[model samples]
Each structure stands twice: as structure tokens, then as C-alpha cells.
Target chain A: MSAVLETRGLGHDYGSRKALDDVSLTLAPGEIVALLGPNGGGKSTLFRILSTVMDASRGEATIAGHDVRRAPADVRQALGVTFQAPSLDRKLTVRENLIHQGHLYGLRGPDLAKRVQVMLEAFGLTDRAGDYVETLSGGLARRADVAKSVLHRPRLLLLDEPSTGLDPAARRDLLRLLQRTRDESGTTCFLATHLFEEAEVCDRVAILDRGRLVALGRPADLVREVGGEVVKLTSDDPEGLAVAIRERFAMEAVVADGEVRMEREDGAALLTPLLAAFPDRILSATVARPGLSDVFFRRAGRAFEEGSDA
Target chain B: MRDQTWLPAFSLWQREMVRFVRQRSRVTGSLLTPVLFWLLFGAGYGGSFRPAGAPESSSFEYFLPGTVVLIVLFTAIFANISIIEDRREGFLQGVLVAPVSRLAIVMGKVLGGATLAILQAVLFLAVAVATRSAFSGGGPGPAGALEAAAALVLLSMGITALGFVFAWRVDSVQAFHGVMNLLLMPMWALSGALFPAAGAAPPIRVLMAINPTTYGLAMLRHGLGRDATGGPAPALAAAVTVGFAVLAVTAAVLVASKRRKTA
Candidate 1:
């Protein structure tokens, strides 16, 4: 089967400011991918382009082989979109929102009704189906929003920050529901999220920074490429400690947010020499296996949180 | 699944109806404003006011059709203004991304607004008829009632579509308020709703002559068998009103077709 979602050198600009630039990636059928980036890192811009809400200034995006700009209706038909902002009509009940969404997708009568019922049940919103969306808690409302989008059994599900405003338990529920949706119907799920945990769970993670696709690979693979371990040390004079480590051991160190961070093949072995070299200056030190943030730091040359302009 | 036009339109229209019914303040506000304006303006101008060529009827009788038109105008304004709200609340974003056509979205919103406007206009007309103050000469029999109803539908659709055009372009309800104050209210006020074009100054008469709504209200006046000497002939007015409705809806569809430049 062809790729469920594909983009070729996709870029967008707001007047003179580049919001996204030359970003290219693809998702296989039934594979879950997360575009992980901090705020202002072009995630929402990419989301808007893929969801067919805005046209990209350069390159192209296609959903199920339909170009988003030239064949928007076809792309819209094959994709389910859940925006970062809550899209449910607050005045309408949970069930009503699903029914209306189904209609928009051309599902009607008893078939649409059955789908709404099934979605409500799957999302754990069956009992609250009759309640107005405004009356629902943030988690319940987010579930309803996702439920309505997927009610028509779309082939590709596009979610933008699906975990925003969701509590820990609610976030887990959402993830489980997404997994179940993919397991049952082979829906290709692509979500833009800032959370590393969310990115780690996806089959692949795409790291966007400064409007560029800096890194893209399976989460574990990307982390593995970051080398053995990440060693972080904090000191009153982080710059001084960083220079001392570089001069004494000829190791590169990044001073960010009052911490001197470095990746090492043998962090356990480096700790002894590193502490001996800066025993007086080092206040705290930690060595742990590399993770997504380490992968981002390796690719983008900055801490994950610092990648955002804000 | 095949892309649907009318199915989505009908669904959106149904949603509008549900929201309107649930918001009690909206229904009441659209009705009360027109009635209050009729009573105040009618009583205040009763002694000195007289429509040209119809001296027997009180100002209350002359203001009746205009008041009913006002109800339609208010309802249209209220209904279409929800577009800005929907945009702010992210409801419109969902619809815009759907497989539904731009025309369907416009039709759904415009027709939904027209339906609400017409219902209120008819209700106000019924009350006016019960008091025997609706038509100028007397009750406009079944044919006249049908004509009046036709004028109401056309007028409601026209104004609602016009409102949709402005509401879609504006980003904020406050900006839409600027549109309402600058465009919509003045459009209604100068449409020969307050006074006859025959009795107005040359420049004012020109404004009324060019105003498309003047023809709609004139058609309504003709249907009610009121004195319509200063306006165009009934057939011509109906044509212009129909043209106005079509033009407004076309503009709305065009605006809806343009996707958001920024998300």
C-alpha cells in the first residue's frame, strides 16, 4: 500500500516570517507518528497545512494520494482532524456533535447513529452523551472532540496537541483510545505533540526545530544514535565548569540553563575524571541513558525546551 | 464515502436551530427590540406623522410593516453574527476542514438565519394582524398574505446573506459590531423603513432608490396593500429583491471559499 500521509519539501511563510521550511516526511499505513516540537517550532503550522486548513507556500502535502491544495475535498474525506483548540460545539451535546460530524462525512441515518454510539462507548463518553459539551470536563470534552472526528472511520487521523489540557489519567486514556483505534481499524495516526512521552510511544518521531525537520526516525533508534549516556552537571559557574571540563578532558560541553551537559560513550567512566577535574565547582551531576531530548540536543544543538523562540 | 452537499448543509442548519432554541435570550431579544421600537416611534410620531397618499391610518399602522422588517433584520444580524463566534470558538475550523463544499456552508448558515428571521417576522405579522394593524387598507387576503410571505422570505435571506459576508471577513465580534453599526443598521434605516421615499429630500431619495432593501420593504408594503407610490412597481421590486438575495449569497460563498491565511 502507498504511504497514508506524505509531504515533499513542505514550507509556509506568514508574510515575511517563515513558519515552516523545507520539511519532508512520510507515514506508512497504520503507523503512528508524532511530530515533536516545542511551541513556535512550526508544529501548528505543519498541522494546519496537513489538515487542509491552510495552503503551504512551497512544496506539497498529500493524504491518501490526494493533494491537499488541488484535491482538498478528497484529502478531507480520507482524514480525521482534531485541532489543538477544542472544536466541539459547546452548545451541542456530545452525541449531537458526533452525529453532525458523521453527516459532514456523508454518513447518514442508522449507520451514522450506530457509529456515534460506538464512538461514545469507545471514548468512555456513553453515559455523558446527552450532556452538553460545555458541561463536560476538559478531559471529557477532549474525548468528545476526538470521538466526533473519528466517528466516520477516517483512514488517517491528524491530531494537533491532542493531550493539551488533559490530566495525566485523561492523557493515558486518549493514548489508549488512539492505540485501540489503530489496532481495530488500521487508522494511520499522526499527532503533533510537545511531550516527549507522547513522542516516545509513537512508532516514529519527527523533531521539528526552527521550521526545519532536524531529525526523523524511530524513537529508540534516534535515542540510540545519541550515544551511550547523557551526563549533566550543575554548578554556580556553569560556564567556568564547562571550560574546565573542555580544557582538562578535551570533551565538548553545552552550557544551558545553568547546567553543563555532555553526551559520552562511557558516562560512568567519564564521571570519575570529570568530578576530579572540577571537584570544587561541580555542585550536582547525573548520568543517564540518552532519551528523545538527548536526540533532539544532538540534532538541533540545543536543549529541547530552548528550541522554542519564546 | 461520497462527499455530501445537502447532507452537511442540513446538518449545520439543524445545529443552528438547536442552538437558537437553547439560547432563550436570543429569541426574546430579536422579538422585543422591534416591538419596543414600533411602540415608541409610533406613539411619539402619531400626532404629526402620516404616510403619503394614506392619511387615514395612524403612524402605528404605517410602522407595522417596517417593524416586522426590523424583526427580520435583527434576527438576521443576531444569527449571522454567530459566525464570528463560531470562528473564535473553533467550531468553524472543523467545518472548513470537512469535505463539505463552501456553498453548502454558506447555504446552511444563510438558510438557517433566514428561517429564524422569517419565523419571527411571521409571528410579529400575526400579532399585528390580530390587532387589525398590519395592512394599510385592511387585511390583505390570502393572495396578499402569500405575497407578504414571499417578500419576508426574500428579505430575510438577503439580509442574512449580507450579514454572513461581513461576519466571515471580520475576525472579531467587536469588528462585526462595527459592521453592524456602520453598514447593517444604516442599510435598514435608509431602506425607506422609517419614512417614505416620496417625502424625503433629493439625496435621501437617491439613497433609498439605490438601496436594495428599499425594494424588499416596498414589496412588503405592496403585499400588505399599503401606499407604495414612491417605490418601484411591485414586479420590479420583487425582481430586485430576488437579485439582491442571489448576489448576497454569491458574495458569501466567495468569501467562504478563501481558506484562512493563518491558522
Candidate 2:
């Protein structure tokens, strides 16, 4: 089967500043992929471009075999988008929102009603179907937003920061709903998210930093690629300690937030050698297994939390 | 391909109607504010002034047609605020991402707003006619009322389209309000709504002549059987009204279809 989505050298610029640069990726049918990035990491820009709301300054993208820039109508027919902000009209009821969404996609009469009912039931919004969206809680509103997007049963679903305002339980429920929908309908899903937990749950995660796709793979595989264990040391002069450890030990070390971090095959073995080499420089030391944040730090040269606004 | 335009357009139009009906404040505010303006302006200018060339009538009657125009103007501004609201609330983005055409979205929103404005204008006109206030002594017959309704349809379409253009560009309702005050208010003030063009200075007369809104008010005045000496001819007013509506709709469609380089 052909790829559900594809991008080649996709780039966008906001005047002098670049939002997305030479980024490219692909997704297979029924796969759930997360475009993992912090704020201002070009995730929203990519989302806007893919959704056909904004034009890329450079490169090309396609959804379901139709070019996004040249054939937005076709792309729109095949794609459903959930924005980071709630898209349900506050004055409209949950069911009204779904029905309107169906009308936009050309589903009418009984067909539209049936699809809306199915979506409401699937999203657990049937009880709240007649309630105005403004009365809904954050999670309920998000479910309505998602339900509105998928009411037309597009082949691919794109969500921007789907878990931004969702509580932990709601987030879990959202993931389960998405998984069930994909499994049952074979609809490919792509989401842009800054939350590591959300990314970890996806079938694959694409780590983006400063408009660049630094890493893309399954969360476990990406973490494993960091190799062995991660060693962290907090010192009075973390920058100097990082350099000294790098030069003396011939190993790469990154300093972030007064802590120096390094990857080693046996982090425990490196701790003894580090203490022997610089007994006064090190204040505290820790050795742990690698995770997605470690992988992000290794690839992006910064912690995931150090994100600025877009 | 299927008829992609009207279904989505009608859906959007229907949504606008539902929203307007549900929001009681919008209905009351759009109607009440203009009536208040009409009453205050009529009382304030009652004994001191009478429009030149118009037949003998009370201040309240002189302001009736203008008040109807005011209701349509107020409704246009009031209804198109939903455009700003939809954008801020992210609902517009959802519609944009859908399979609907840009033209359909434009038609949906513009027509939706126009429909609301026209409905409110007609309601206000109906109340005036029923109360016998539309004409104190001599009034336009049924045919004139029909012509007035037709003129209002065109005027509301044009005014609502203009509002849509502004609402699409502004980011906040506050900013849209500022724009309406600065742009739309001046357009209404100089459109012969408050005063006849015959009494204005040459420069103001020039301004009135060029303003498209002047034609709308003239059309309204003619439909109401008022003396229209200071305004354009009835035929000219009708042509300009249609032209204005077409131009405004085109501008709205263009603005809606613009693609930005950044989100």
C-alpha cells in the first residue's frame, strides 16, 4: 500500500526566522506517528502546512496521493485535522458541531445523522450531545473537537497538540479512543505533540528541534540508540566540568541546568573514574537507563523542557 | 463533480441562524440599540430641524427609513462579529480544513450575516408599519414597502459583505469594534442617514456623492416615498446598490481565499 502521507524537504519561514527547514517524513496506513517537538520547534508550522492552511516557503507535501499545495480540496477530502485550540463552536451543541462538520464534508440526511451518532458514542459524548460546547469541561470539549474532525471518516487524521489541555485520565482515554478508531477503521493518525508521554504511546515518534528532524523511530528504539546508561553529574562549575570530563575521558558531555550528562556503556564504571579524576569538581552523581528525554538531549543538544514559544 | 457550493453554504447559513436564535442577547442588542438611537436622535433634532425637500412630516417619521437602515447596519456589524469569534475560537480553521470551497465559505458567512441583518431590518420595518409610525400622514403603498424590502436585501448583503471583509482581517472583537467605529460609522453618518445631503457643505456633498452607502439610504428614502432631491436618482441608486454588493462580495471572497506564509 502507498504511504498515507509524505513530505519532501518541507520548509517554511516567517520573514527572517525559519520555522521549518528541509524536514521530510512519511507515514504508512493505519500507523500512529507523533511529531514530537517543544514549542517553537516547527511542529505547528508543519501542521499548518499539512492541513493546507498555510503555504510552505519551500518543499512539497502530499496526503493520500494528492499534493497539499496544488490540490488542497483533494487533500482536505482525505484528511481530518484537529487543531491545538478547541474548534467546536461554543454556541453549538456537540451533536450540532458533528452534524455541521458532516455537512461540510458532503454527508447529509440519515447518513450524516448515523455518522454523528457513531462518533458521539465512540467519544463518550452521547450524554453531552445536546449540551452546548461552552458548558463542557476541557477534556469533553477536546473529545467533541476530535469527534467533529472524524465525523466524515477521512482516511488520515491529523491532530495538533492533542494532549495540551487534557488531564492524565482524559489523555489516556483519548489515546485509547484513537487506537481503537485506527484499529477498527485503518485510518492513519499523525499528531504534533510536545508531551513525551503522548509521543511514547505512539507507534513512532519524530523528534524535531529548531526546524530540524533530528531523530525518528519507535520510542524504545530511539532510547536504545542512545546506547548503554546515562550518567549525570551536578557540580559548581558544570560547564568546566563538562569540558574537563570530555577532554580527559575522551567522551562527549553536555551541560544543562548545572548538570553534566554523558552516555556510557557502563555508567557505573565511568562514575568511579570520574571521581578519581576530579574529586573536587563533582558534587553529586547519578546513573540511569536511557529514555526518550535522554535521546532528545543526545540528539538536540538541549533538554526537551527548554522550549520557547513559537 | 457534485454541487459542492450550496450544501455547505446552506449548512453554514443554518448554523448562523441557530446561533443567532440561541443567543438572545445578540437579538435584543441589535434591535434595541438602533431603536434607541432613532428615538434619541428624533427627539433631539425634532423642533430644530426638518430635512430639506422632504414632504411635511414629523422628526420621528423622517428618521424612520434611516432607522431601518441603522438596524441593518447594526445587525451587519453584530452578525459579522461571529467571524472574529469563530477565528479566535478556532472554529474557522476547522471549516478551512474541510473539503468545502473558499467560495462556499464566503457565500455561507456573507449570506448568513446578510440574512440576519435583513431579518432584523424587516422586523423593525414591520413594527413601524404596524404601529402606523412609518407614515404619519402619507406613506408608501404596498409596492413601495416591497421595493424598500428589496433595497434592504441588497443593502444588507453589501454591508454584511463589507463587515465580513473587516472581521476576517481583524484578530479581536475589540479591534473589530474599533474598525466599525472608525470606518463603518463614518460611512453611515455621511450616507444621508442622519441628515439630507442638500444642506451639507460642498466637500461633504462630494463625500456623500462618492460613498456607496449614500445610494443605499437614497434607495431606502425613495422606497419610503420621501423626497429624494439631495440624493442620486432611484435607478442610479439601485444600480450602485447592486454594484456595491457585488464588489463587497468579491472583496470578501478574495480576503477569505488569501493564503498566508505563516500560521
Candidate 3:
């Protein structure tokens, strides 16, 4: 499969503050990639540039072989986007909203009507077709939004945090629908999400922090890269414990929130010894398999939690 | 056959109509605000305050054109407010990512707003006609009323396009509301909607002369035969109104099409 989307050295800034700095990524046709990042990590800026809703400040991007800067209309024709916010007209019925969207894509007459019907049934919004969007539940409105985006049957789909406000069941439905969309229509789906669970389902995940791509790999690959357990120890004197740990293991430790954490290939084997070495200062110690958070910690040095001083 | 260029514009126009029906508060506000102003102001000002230009007209008769203008102004502002909300609400991002041209987007929205303004302005126009017959001793014939309605539509299209110029750039609805107050309120004040230009100070009169809605008000006044109010000929006013509508729409399209060049 060829690359359906590609970005090279994409950078953007709002005045003095840089939002995205020299980010590059690629996605194959029919692949689902999650852009995972905390808030203010430039996920939205990158998504906007890729969707051609906003131009990149100093880089290049192409969707479906059409350059975003030089041929935005062509890029638009090739992709569908579900925004982080609700886009439906609350005063209009679901069917009316879908039909209006269809018209914008130059669909009209019997064909437009038929597509509206198809989208309504696809999202299970058929019964609420004549009800105003404001009256629908949050999940149904979100489904209507996704349905509206895919009405044109574009080759790639971009959703900015589709599960932000959904219940678990609704989130599950969204996930299944996304996969079904890819399977049935051969659409490559890309979404920006802060939730690890949402990112775990993607075939590939790109982790961004501070406007840079810090890690990129399959979710499981990232977790397995530690090759061992992560040992986290809280101590009465974290500074003294960290110093003793560095002296004994000859390996650096990341200290965050009065706790010291380190990756250890033989963590289980050395746990008793490490505890003995720091018996006076050590308060508690736990060893666990690596998670996405551990992968982030490995790359960023800062704790995955926002409570870190960095 | 391919979808015609007007399809999107027509679709938006239909949506505006549907929303107008569903949202009763919007419908009530658009129709009632102008009438309330007219009645309260007309009764308070009384029938004796004819302007220097048209000395034979009653104050209520003179306020009729202004009432129609207010309806046009009110509806234009309220209808196009969706532009601001669409951005914060996400519908605009969907539109921005669509294959549709910028001209089509502006055209669809401006036309939709203009249609709604015209629809509501007609309701006020009917009340004006009835009041005129009861008090002014004369009113526009059927042909004249039709012409006045057309003028209201043209005026609505022009002012709504102007609304789009501000709305396309502002992200916040409150900021757009501020623009409406700081800019559109003055435009309406000098539009000869509240007072005739002949009675105003020279500078205020000049502002009225320069205001496009002033010409629209003149066109409506002449169509209804409310003594012409020292305005230019009806034909001249119509030309200016049409020219203003086209220019505002072109400006809006230009603003909407540009790709945030400052970035």
C-alpha cells in the first residue's frame, strides 16, 4: 500500500509560541494511526494542517498525492474530517443536516437523498431522522457527525478526539464503526486522542510531546521495548535513595513526585537486593510490566503524569 | 447532470428557513423587535414631527421605512451569527475541509441570511401598510408593495454580506456581537432609518449619504410614496443598493477565501 498521507518538517507557531516544531510522519492507505498526546501537544495544529483547514507555516504535506498547499481542494476531495466539537446544526433534523452536507459536496437530487438515507441507517439515526439534532443524545449526535463526514466516501478519514465525551458503550460503538468503515470502504483512518485506550486500538501510534514526535511504533512494540519491568520506589528521602540507587546500579533514575523510577532488565531478581541496599531510606517499592506511560517516560524523561515539574 | 452552482446556496437557504421555523424565539425576536420600536417610538414621537424634507408626512409614516430597515438589520445580524458559532461549534471546520469553493460558502450563507431577513421584514411591512392606510390617508399599491419587498431583500443581502465580512474573521460570538454594536449600529443610525438626512447636522447628513442602507431606505420610501424624504430618485437608489450588495458579497468572498496569510 502507498502512503495516503505524508507530512515533512511540519512546523507552526502562534506568534512567539511554537505549536508544532519540525514534525514529520506518514500513513499507508487503510492504516489506522493514532496521534496520541496530552492537551497543548500540537495534535490539533497538525490535524488542521493535514486536513487543509489551515496551512502549515513552514513544511509540506500531501493527502492522496495532492499537496495541501498547492491543491487544497483536491486534498479536501480525498479526505473526511470529524472535528473535536459537535458540528451538527442543532435546529435542523438529522436528515436535513446530512442532506445539507451532501449538497456541499455537489451531491443533489435522487442521489443526495439516497446518500442521506444510507448515512442515517449506517449510524442508526434513521428513527431520529426527523428530530432536531439538539434533541438527540450526545452519542447519536456524534455518530451523525461521523456519518456526515463519511457521506462523501472519501479515501481517508480524520477525527480529532472522537471519544472525548462518549460513554464507554458509545466509545466502543465508535471504535467498531471506525474499523467497519475501514474494512468496508478501504478508508485510512487517523485520529488524535489523549486516551491510551483509544490509541491502543490503532495499528500504529505516534506519540507527540512539546510539539515533537517523541515515540512512534505499534502500541505493544512500544510497551515491549523496555525488555523488562519498571521498578518504582518511594522513599522517606527520595534524593538519598536515588543517589544510593545510582551508586549501586550505576544507572540513572527519574525522580518525580517524591518517587524514583527506573527500568531494570533483571528488576525482579534485584528487587530484594535494592531494597536491602536502601533499607534505611526506602519506604516502598513496586515492579510492573511496561505500559504506554512507561514508554513515554523512557522517551521524555519526565513522568507521563502532568504532576511532574517539567 | 452535475449539481448546479446554486445547489449549495439553495440548500443553505432551505436550512435557514427550516431553522427559522423550528426556533420560535428567533422568529419572534426578528418580527417583534422592529414592531415594538416602531410602536413605542412612533407613539412617543407622535404624528407632528415631520422632517424638513417631507413636511406633509406623519412621524409614524416617516418611521415606516426605518422599521423595515430595522427588521432587515436585525434579521441580518441574527441569521449570520451562525458563522461565528459554526467555528466554535465545529460545523465550519467541516465546511472549510469540504471541496466547495469559498465563493460558494459565502454565497450560500449570505443568501440564506438575506432570505430570512426578507421574510421577517415582510411581516413588519404588512403592519406598516395597515398603519399607513389608517393614519397617513394613502399607501403603496400592490405593485408598489412588491417593489418595496424587493428593495428590502436587496438591502438585506447587502447588510448580511457586510455581516459576513466581520464574522468570517472573528471566532467568538461575543466579539461578533461587539462588531455588530460598534459598526452595524452606527451604520443603521446613519441609514436615515431613525431621522431624515435633511434634518441632521451636515456631517451626519454626509454619513447618511455615504451609507448604503440610506439609499435602500430611500428606495423603499419612494416605492411607498412617503414623500421621498429628500432621497435620490428611486432608480438611482435601486442601482446603489444592488451595487452595494454585489460589492459587499465580493468583499466577503475575498475575506473568506484568503488562507490566513498572516500565519
Candidate 4:
């Protein structure tokens, strides 16, 4: 019922450059919220603050009723964080990595062993438990990393780009397991990822742009904001066609990457007039309902910047 | 809640042990590097070299403690390099976020490195005993063996923690290696491991006496019934070694887990 995680105007600055600026977020318990943003979009900064590894320069964050800045120990006890990098030692076996993680949380003896067994079984890693982490495939290693993070079964799980570098099968399995875990145990899952598809499965998606929260809502509702259909007209001279269409229909048409695109209540009503107006310049036109990227385009104008190094 | 440092520290140590056991190259490298140094440097410098005021032991026998110390340094440096790599790749962020004390993490890593360093040096001690008996005079007795093992552990702890301090400050692996050479090598060379301070020039003798490692070597030499270069009494030597360990560990924890500006 209460917010599992909440941040108020959280900001971070790297010397003169601001990495996060006046960003606020709230996540409810047992809900899967995805922070979808391009690289350098402050997703990591927010995650770091939530994990209590980095102190916010401005404002505050609380995790599971404890302030992350003033009460890191409490926050840590409530949170399980999985890194983007290879945290498991390449030289140690998968089981050993889990064992170490458990001990870090003060789980020991038979209890620790039992937890490891449960995690290995849950993640389908029993067969590969004895294998060195370096020897395991990338997907298996990532599975081990995830399993190790949740070994102590913290109240909140924070994953950074968990789907990156994972194959489609592994990615699908990870989402399934996470969703099942949340449904079964009522654990809160908040993940930061750039993949729009990954965010689609989450209950809520918070889209960040250049260190600021640009949009926040359900993926479906956000896309629905750009309701009806979008028309993309491919032409050799998209700017000229866009001007022509702007004059003819008095509707705003934007050209991006040499493609003239516009949205309307009914895209078919505008396609005939637009094509007839620029028959020589326009090559083709297609009408389709807006997707998540279309939602982002509506909000940010340009497409989501790719390959951010947040 | 009261701090539960032991569990996390022990876990880190366990991970280090498991890693060392799994990597064959690590096992071989830690074991063989000291032996190679002892054979090549000891033999080459044996026949023609003799320090004034030194005992009747052959040069190879005299080089034993130095080679063992070198192994400890090597193992510590080797183990702490992982810290630099981990920080660069963000592996350490996972560990830092755990509800564990920063000191516990440092202790875990240092203890792990120390255990491996001491273990490898103890294995090499057998060779030292045999070579000393056959070539020089005789091996250290049971008391000497106990003393050598304890000294190796303290030396390992100090060196490993020192490596942690340097590795924490350096961002790249290349810089870490460069720092290890600059920090560890000079200390080893001047610790009366290679040459005794008794017959050295006034400046060199003073440097050896002032070096904390000189006391470690002195303790090692005394434990094995060998005379030291008048560095210090074994009691004082042990105190200084422990002191170095404490200081290095404190510095390391402070630097690596400094109050990061983001939570």
C-alpha cells in the first residue's frame, strides 16, 4: 500500500555537469516498475541512490520506510541490487558465488546451504552449480548473478540493465522468473533498462530523458496518449512534403531522418490528400497505431537517444 | 543491530580461497615464483657473494627468508589486483550495497590474500628447510617453523592491506602493477631479505633498520635461530608488523568506501 521506494527531487552532479536534476519517483510494493531511459539519462544515478551506494546531492530517497541517505543499513537490509557488470568471480563456481553472497547477509550453516539450493533450483542452475563462472555461458553467468542477488530474499529487488547482453530466451526466462517471484512472494521489483520491450511487461514505466523524468505511467496508457493512428510518409524531399502538408491540411507534420510523419484521429483521411499533393516527391505512406517509441517521440520530439553510457 | 563483520569477512575470504583453488595458473604461479627466484637469484648470487659480519651459512641459505617474503608480496599483489579490476567493472558496487561494514570487506580481502600467501610460503618452507640442510647448515626447528608461519601471516596481512590501499586509489590494472613495483619491490629489497644491514653502507643500513619489513625479516630470522642485522628485538618487530597491518587496513577501507555522493 505504501510506497516501497520513493525519491523527492533527487539530483546528482558530476563536478560541473549535472547527471540527475530534480527527478522524483515513487514505486509501490509488489509492483514491477521499469526506468526506461537512454544512456546518461540518470537511471543509474537513481538506482545507485536507491541502493544506498551513492548519496544524492539534492533531495531525498527512502526504501522500505528507511531513508537511503540517513539509514543505509536499513535500506540495504530491505534491498537487493544486481550490478550491470560481471560481479561473480570468474574463478569461483556458481554455487560458491551464491554462498559468499549469503554469508555477506549473515546467512550461514545449514540455512545458507538451504537458501543456495532453493535459488539454484529456482534459477535452474543445479546442473551448472559446480561449474566455474567463467566456464558458464553469458546467460548462465547472468542467471547466477541474479540468483546470488536474491539469495537473501530482500524486500526490494533492483536490477541494472539485466536484459542487456542476454539472448532472447534468457531475457524471456528472466522476466518470467521475476514476474513469478513477485507474484509468489510479493517482492517489489524495480529495474532500469533501455529496452522498451522489457518495460512493456512492467506495471509502470518511468521514462527519463537527459537526467529528468519526462514521462511516467503505464506503457499502454502512455502509448494511448498518442491515440488513433500515425502516418509515416517516406519521400526523397520530406521537408518539402512536410511544408506542403502543413499548408494543405493546417496540421503539424514533422520530418525526422528523411521521413515525414504525422498523426491524426483517422490517418486514412489525410493519406490521399498528402500523396496527391506530392506525388513526385513522396514514395510511400503507411498508417499504424502508435507504440511506446511513438509515445516517446510525441513527448521528446526526436527518437529516444540510443547507446547511453549511464 | 550490533555489527556482524565476521560473517561477511569470512565469506570474502572463502571466495578468495575458492578462486585460488579453481585457477590452476594462480596455484602454480604463487608456488613456483618464489622457487624460481630462490634458485636463480640465490644460486647466481651464492658463490661469489658474502656479506661482512654474516654467518657461515651459504649465500643460498641466507637468501631463503628474502625469497619467502617475495612470495608473500607477490601473492598479496596478485590478489589485490582483483580489487582494481572489480572497481573498474563495477563488481564492487554489489558488495558495497550489502548491509555489511566496509571494514569487514577489507578484512575479508586482506585475510583471504594473507591465507593464500602464508599457505604458499609454508609449502615453500619445506624446500627452504631441505636446501638449507643440504647446502648451508640445517633447517629451522619446530619453534622456528611456528615462528616463520606466524611471521608470514603478519607479513601477508600487512602487504595485502597495503596493496588494497594502492589498488583502491589506482583506476587501471597497468597503474596498479606500476604501483606494486614501486611500493613492494623497494620494501622487499631493503628489508634485509636480499642483503644484511650489518655490513652495508651507513645510509643503506639506516634504511634497512627504519623499514618495517626489516623487523619482519628480523623476526623471521630470529624464529629460525638465525641472527638478524641488529634490526630490532622480535617483540618490537611483531608490534610494528601488527601496527602496519592496522594502519594499512584502515587507510584501505577509508579510501575504497569513501562517502560516495549519490544515495
Q: Please, what is the TM-score per model?
A: 0.96, 0.95, 0.93, 0.94
lDDT by residue (B104-195, candidate 4, tens digit) is 88898899988898878777876666545323455678888788778888888888888888887777989987887787889999998888
lDDT on C-alpha atoms for all candidate structures? 0.88, 0.87, 0.82, 0.82
What is the Cα-based TM-score of model 4?
A: 0.94
Q: Residue by residue across A1-310, what tens digits does model 4's lDDT show?
A: 8988888998889887788889888888789988888887788888887888778889888888899888988889888988787678777788888888887888888988998999999989999999888899888888888888888887899999988888989898888888887887778888899888898888999888778888899999999898989999998888888898899889989986568888889999877877777778889899998887787777766767534443
True contacts kept of each: 0.89, 0.90, 0.79, 0.81
Q: Which residue pairs come into collision in candidate 3? A: none
* A93-163: candidate 2 lDDT, tens digit per residue: 88888888888888899978988888889889899999999999999998899888877777899999988
Q: Which candidate, 2 or 3, would have the higher TM-score against the true structure?
A: 2
Instruction: Please give the clash total of every predicted structure, in order.
Output: 0, 0, 0, 7
Candidate 3 residue B87 Cα shift, in angstroms, is: 1.9
lDDT for each residue of candidate 2 in B19-129, tens digit (9 for 90 to 100): 989989998888888988888987888777788876677788888877888888888887788888888889999999988877788788778877887788777777777
Q: How many backbone clashes does candidate 4 have?
A: 7
What is residue B241's positional error in candidate 3, in angstroms? 1.4
* Better model by DockQ: candidate 2 vs candidate 3: 2
Query: Which sequence of candidate numbers ranks them by DockQ, best first?
Result: 2, 1, 3, 4
Off by over 4 Å in 2: A243-251, A269-284, A308-310
**Candidate 4: RMSD to truth:** 2.3
lDDT of 1 by residue, B73-183 (tens): 888888877898998899998998889999889888888978887788878878877777555456787887788888988888889989998899888888898888988
